[model samples]
Target: MIIKRVIRSQNRVIVEGKNLVKKHIKQGPGHEGGIFTVEAPFHASIVQVLDPVTGKPCKIGVKYLEDGTKVRVSRGIGASGSIIPRPEILKMRATPRPTVAGPKDTPNESCAGEDTRS
Candidate 1:
């Protein structure tokens, strides 16, 4: 594996790999000598170099099969899943709503913004 790009921020580092995207440039109809290229970047966090046997995080472990292919396994360490509250979960759903409403449409508009209690 080749290390392409790396960015360090505080206690974390972000890395980009070349395998993320394949660049292709093709000449258009009656096009000049301008080269066209497509570039795509993948998140480094999506990939990990782990052991072949276990599907966990690992510092170093690799094995090649008889078919000349390499296998990897996680190094036995990974981030834990997150836990969210029920109210917070509902906030992510979609709900229908009116397009627009005028001041006269709702008689309580003015009162709603004001504090009724002295």
Candidate 2:
């Protein structure tokens, strides 16, 4: 199963096509009420990362390269010891950063009128 999201605080994950549940919604303002099928969160301990080389579930181990770059590798039983690359979703930001500063940001220039020596 593909992991859709990881909730660190709750130690749970949302996997695709797993732990499916039905949710009942009540009618409200600008909202429709009905039963909806949704994916429920499950403990991360139950899931294992699949090794790319062996295509089997295996325990993950951290390894550092000669250049001091850290990476995850498959270990333990049925392990291939292959480096696991980070998913593309993990590299993407939920909200993009603004290039221009907003009103809340302080001006880059220093206060010229303020006295320096006190």
Candidate 2: clashing pairs of residues: none
The lDDT per prediction is 0.46, 0.91
User: Clash number for every model?
Assistant: 12, 0
Model 1, position 61, has a per-residue lDDT of: 43
Residue 16, candidate 1: C-alpha displacement in angstroms = 8.4
- Candidate 1 residue-wise lDDT, 25-116, digit = tens: 56678865444443344555655553335434445345566898654323335522222113343356456565678555766556677877
User: Tens digits of per-residue lDDT for model 2 on 5-40?
Assistant: 999899999999999999999999999999999999
The best candidate in terms of lDDT = 2
Candidate 2 local lDDT, residue 78? 78
TM-score of each: 0.23, 0.59
